[model samples]
Target chain A: MAPMRIDQLTPGTVAHIVAIDLDELGERRLREHGLDEGVEVELLHRAAFGADPLAVRVGNACVAMRRSQAAGVTVRVAQRLEAAE
Target chain B: MSEVMTAPVVALVGNPNAGKTSLFNALTGARQKVANYPGVTVERKAGTLTLPDGSRAELIDLPGAHSLEPRSPDEEVTRDVLVGAYAHERVPDAIIAVVDATNLASQLRFVLELKALGRPMVVALNMMDLAERDGFFIDYEALARELALPVIPTVAVRRRGLEAVIAAARDALNAAEISAIRSADAPAMLVEAIGDMRGHQRQARDIAAKVVSGGDANQMTRQIDRLVLHPVSGPVLLAVILFLMFQAVFAWATPFADAIEGAIGWAQGIVMTSLPAGPVRGFLTEGLLGGVGAVIVFLPQIVILFAFILVLEQSGYMTRAAFLMDRLMAGVGLSGRAFIPLLSSFACAIPGIMATRSIADPKDRLTTILIAPLMTCSARLPVYAVIIAAFIPDRTVGGLANMQGLVLFGLYAFGVVGALAAAWVLRLTVTKGAGGGFLMEMPKYQLPAIRDLAIGIWQRAWAFLRRAGTIILVSTMVLWVFASYPKAPDGVSQVDYSIAGRIGAGLEVVFAPIGFNKEISIALVPGMAAREVAVAALGTVYAIDADDEELLEVELADRLRGAWPLPTALAFLAWFVFAPQCISTFAVTRRETNGWRWPIFMFSYLFVMAYLGAGATYWISKWALGG
Candidate 1:
């Protein structure tokens, strides 16, 4: 499957992180939070009204990140149970 | 062995919301005082822990960082202290790397990076209870074996498995070669070693996968997230929470405020009855009892205000709040992390500015600090109250909300709008830099720990009293001297010939454009001390009777109504919305920014804004009313 930016995922979409193209510092911070390749990320939802920053679940932690930041992260879509496998 | 060190130092490092601070409080108990890292505003928190064998270890809680690489001044301080490069802080004899057990894969990377430094260290797998509740069956022993270091499982909030961690720390401190990691050469070498974090991440994942963990996703957290992160309901919920918090600060705290007011009044009555009528009496009854006591009266409101912030923060709601505010703030080029600091500024700008130290990006922190004083703090309540009381009628609208209340609400809204506009301008002009997109770790939702909340409130309340006693008291006395001196030139109401009156008369020329007369010009000098002081200042200048402190607000409002024109009164209200901030706010800005540049800039900008805003309001109101 073609990898898409994580920000493209809608609520209920679970994707496996393929790559992160952010700055070194930001990429390192994401890696420290278990957003490395093959880690499963579930797009939670966007914030109310503005809907700019998106929330996602990664490794039992809920992360709130800007859409611009999420765009730097590439992911392959998968079912939640499939990603668990 | 390099040497046996006295008073062994241990650095506790971790990622944000990793339970590092919770473990520190549990380990240190009550013996902790936060001071500044020399020449900077970032806090240096150290506490003493007595080992079972009577040996003492000083534990320093380092600010959370992503890795050994430093990004901003705040993170640089942490990295420098770790590498012994910080000139003021000693490199620790041992390092305690606290990691959250629930998400081992994410936290283990920082552990691996810190391990490369070759420090005598132990890993505290904190929040073990939460991990277990989430069905994360972590083989901490296997993880320990993989790192070849002691891994102690701990529940920081509950203090579970605390003894094992303490035992490990003591052993690491007492072991040989404490100086190995303390050497200057190790940091540069280690930085190079950890440069390839992709390799480290791979290794960390391998170990985490092998720790024989049967992972069970938390159903409770997932369910809660569904509600809190709902597109429609999320922001609505946030607004409701914030509204309740502000409303409670006023409603829930009134009884306590009244009690405090009654107590101070009683004490003042006793003193006034006994003392002879002279300058000593005036100083005691008015300056100390009335002026300083006025600031202290807001303690109940302050306490209630911070209680909400502390609970929201510790309960994991603040991160959610940040997420909610991100898009709104991102329009102005600010990250989500600036949310809490700006929120706290509504109570007082001092802590709000200090809270920015946790933001690792210096530009974001600076931007947040610059806009903090515009949040309309509790100290501005009195000025607003006196104005609204004097001008706005006390009728009910829709039989629920008072006319006066709706006006007050409009004023609050105006202050907030002004703050947002100011922040946007500041970010675009000065202090503009590469904007970092918001990314924050969302900690699991949990009930706030009572002990931690109690300690937090106690510390803030104490600081409030201390500041009231020193700075507020001194400024009050200075105001009194300015009002009472020069003997009234033997006939002119003890003020017309005084230094303060003369200065106010001369300053009226500059202030006249904003519709301020001599009395208001006089009040402005003392209002620089604090926003609330302007009320009492104007009250005294107008020669209101001083028999009862309780009647002061009422008397002042009537005196103001009979004296000033309605347009001039409206102008004064506009002035306070963007008033040139209290001296203490500027003082805090100086400390937080570590320079005079930002403080001077802040004062000048706010002064100009207040002057223009007041003038516009006065002329507009006059036109509308056909005055």
Candidate 2:
């Protein structure tokens, strides 16, 4: 999966969180918040104002994340196609 | 040798991830209090360690620092304390320069700078186990020779290698004519030298590297990281975890909280039966039991809440949550740096305000300090628990979620929303400018050490008890005096004419628009002192009207249901969410910001928001519920 900017993900888009490119402190922090990898995620909402942080749904919870940190997260957009298209 | 002797005072200093607090807790046990250095708002934690030879040495834990030169208030404390310039105390007899052995290539720059301070010192190469697991081999003798200081490998969390740490400290304390290491004038020199020394990193790694190995652990951590940091699953897991924590606060604490309530009622009955009608009886029943007992009943919930917080903090999951939320915070005109302080606010505002020192920008720090009190603290738990239990129906929401926990989570969510909105307004009207950028260090994932977690929880419990015993004691006595005297006319209960009742009645006029009765109005006054006192105040007022002692929550709830209405209860909860912070928060804000302007701004804005929010809640609920 190639890395996608957080803005690319939509409300129903399912993607795998690939990697967090934070420094030692950032990596430590990402791990502490339970945001490592192999987890499925969906974009729930985005801020309508300045520096819009994305509201993301992982599992059953929702969190708002910054774009800088989100940029480090690689994702593969889940493909949804009609059964007989 | 009949000579005078003195025990050495050792100060432990390190970066935030260097396990300094764990080392301090390991050395001192439970004999420590968190305080600030005089004239500086940074936390100063000190404790005494009894050496093996019957000598007692004082251990101080300074604020975490990246370098000796200060940028934030916390780093300044580290620098000031190291150089003997802080107001509260002079420099320690020796400095324990704690470094994360795993990240030594970066952390050592600070260690090198500290060594240059020429203070009697020892290098505590903490987390050596993690370093070796990462394939780093440190030769302690080589590093010790290079720095000309005693180097000891320490796994502070496990209490391993402490004997070596203590021994090294003793050796440094006893040594004579130690060479004065030259100080680095600029941070760049130390950075450059640290970079140059990277080639020798393998040789400088402490301990027999293989002895502290964790080959499988790294692989496991990597695997766990995949799911936890996943974009798809991470947020869901975080929400579930938080939901469970809130549920535990409600479901698990109820039985214990009920038991405490029963015990208080039983004790109240005994006192009422044993004493003849007089001030003594009134004092025992109303002042002592009514005020203090009411607050104490909520201890179970607080303990449970702390248990979850401590576990999360100890397991090192909190930083990841901060990282995940940074963007959200930035979106609302807050720096990601506000995450730690705001998280700490869930426990209490005092530490949260103090923690703002981690934020380098003055405006951001002030903004965080101003809004932290809005983040529903544990003290408010008693208030919320009592009110929610009384008014809200006990049922499940969304078929699977507990209604009570959802309400609790909603309250927290309200606080977060209110905080961001306040920050947004403040940024627009008060402090308008692009401020500092976000820079936070995340630590590696680790299983929470039980001993360290236990110690942290114990410290919080002890602090809570101490506050209950002292401040609550004095305030309750004063309130008792106000509520006791100026007897009512014949055929009326004295409480109707008592100062508290009169004041409550007077305040009710102002709050009546918001659906608050006299009793609730009175509760809000002392509540400004601290949130828990509001519960006690209700107990004290309601005791005068009851035929027998009832559980404070039950009696208060029943009283509100009969006298006021659902709108009033909901409005009161809304008021608490945006109320001008308790007095202690203001005191801390003043100390933290070093002025009254920010505190004044905070109070004025919160007061406005509280009134508006409460008024809106009252009207909307009244119209909606057909009140």
In terms of lDDT, which candidate is strongest? Answer: 1
Docking class of 2: incorrect
On DockQ, the candidate that comes out on top is: 1
lDDT of 2 by residue, B1-627 (tens): 225565557889887868998998888887887776666566678888776676778899988876665668888777766666666775576788898776554466567667656667899989877767767667767777766788898999889888788877766656522533223332444344334332322332332232223332234444454565556565677778877887888789888878987887788778878888778887788778878887887777778878888777766677656655666677667876687788788889888898888887788887888889898898888888878878888898779977777888899889889999888877776767775655445466677777777877787888888888877766776777777777677788766788988988899899888888888887777777788888888877776655444533355656655666788888888998988848988888887777898888889988989999999999998999886
Q: Rate the local accuracy (lDDT) of all candidates.
A: 0.81, 0.72
| Residue B132, candidate 1: C-alpha displacement in angstroms | 1.6
- What candidate 2 gets wrong by more than 4 Å, as runs, is A1-85, B1-6, B176-218, B548-554
The CAPRI classification for model 1 reads as: medium
Q: Model 1 over residues B63-118: C-alpha lDDT tens digits?
A: 88877776556667878888878899978889999998887787788898888887
Error of 1 at B299 (Å): 0.4
Predicted structure 2: lDDT:
0.72
Q: Mind giving the per-residue lDDT tens digits that candidate 2 earns over A1-85? A: 4567545776657777666676665544333333445545676554333434555554323444565656666777765665343
